[model samples]
Target: MTTSLVRIGLATALLLGSIGAAAAHAHLKASTPAAGTTISAAPAELRLGFSEGVNLKFTGVVVTGPAGVVATSTAAMAPGDDKTLVVPVAGPLAPGAYKVEWHALATDGHKTDGSYSFTLKP
Candidate 1:
């Protein structure tokens, strides 16, 4: 009986460990323009903050404006912050809805992607 209880406890511990690890994947925490925000002026860059550190080589952002496919530079991590992604917008954005599509590869090897839209007020 004792041996069976010990085995059960070990199994439960392993299961919990796996669950914790699975929850560690990078998740969008916040942004500069902020999700669903309406700004009076065009933002020079898009900033994304994640729950975990990300790998920029496998991470990127795609911006689409009224004209579609607004050019953006490759995403790079903040100078000393691995959890923040900085993407430079190539030019001024027009007054309209803009969508930012982002993909990130967490340091733990997990991949996550999400998109959000913000309106540019005229």
Candidate 2:
């Protein structure tokens, strides 16, 4: 009887602990260009600022250039002391609004997704 009671208590604690952890608050705070800012020229790089620290290894930026998705070599950098990252622009963007679709997983394992656009000056 005692062993069964102990097992129930342990299971209850584990379930509660998992629920609390999964409810962690983590989200993207802001971003440069404000999601729809038009630039006179193509920026050398793209940057993003988040509300919390994130795992850079699981993060990436997919830039849909004039034609299609631009190729990139560098992987997104993980969060450091600064909750911002400087994502490398795959290549020179054409004169038009380019879309940037980004996704990042916070330290708590919650994923955030967002998209932004910038004009390369026609």
Candidate 3:
């Protein structure tokens, strides 16, 4: 009886822990022209993949490059993919280093933000 109770307690604890983890805020999982990579050609748009679905209305990214603030269109969720945020670049990016700052609101109502940098080959 005691062994059975111990097993039940462990099982309950594991279940509760997993539930808590599932509620975590969205996290950046991947990106186009990926972090710390050098690309010879400019990307017309930026694609950001998150760990979970995000609310498009509450998510965005700000890109800054060698010349300063880069122009980008309003962010949108990739069609049929709520976990990916797509932002269009207004024009070509100059050769140099660029930093992308992003903030996201998960569908679950949790918020998260982060930044990454990449270099453009001349």
Estimate, for each residue in 1-122, the C-alpha lDDT of model 2 and write its tens digit: 69999999999999987985666534556665557677786676777777777677877688886778866557654445446766776667677767878888778777878887766777
Candidates 1 and 2, the one with greater lDDT: 1
For model 3, the superposed segments whose C-alpha errors exceed 4 Å read 1-22
- Residue by residue across 19-119, what tens digits does model 3's lDDT show? 86677679999999799999999999999999999999999998999999999988889999999999999988999999999999988788999999999
lDDT of 1 by residue, 8-91 (tens): 999999998798678889999999899999999899999999999999999888889899999887768999999999999888
- Whichever of 2 and 3 has more TM-score, that candidate is 3
How many clashes does each candidate structure show, in the order listed?
0, 1, 0
Error of 2 at 75 (Å): 3.7
Candidate 1, superposed: residue stretches over 4 Å from native: 1-17
TM-score of each: 0.84, 0.72, 0.82
What TM value does model 1 have? 0.84
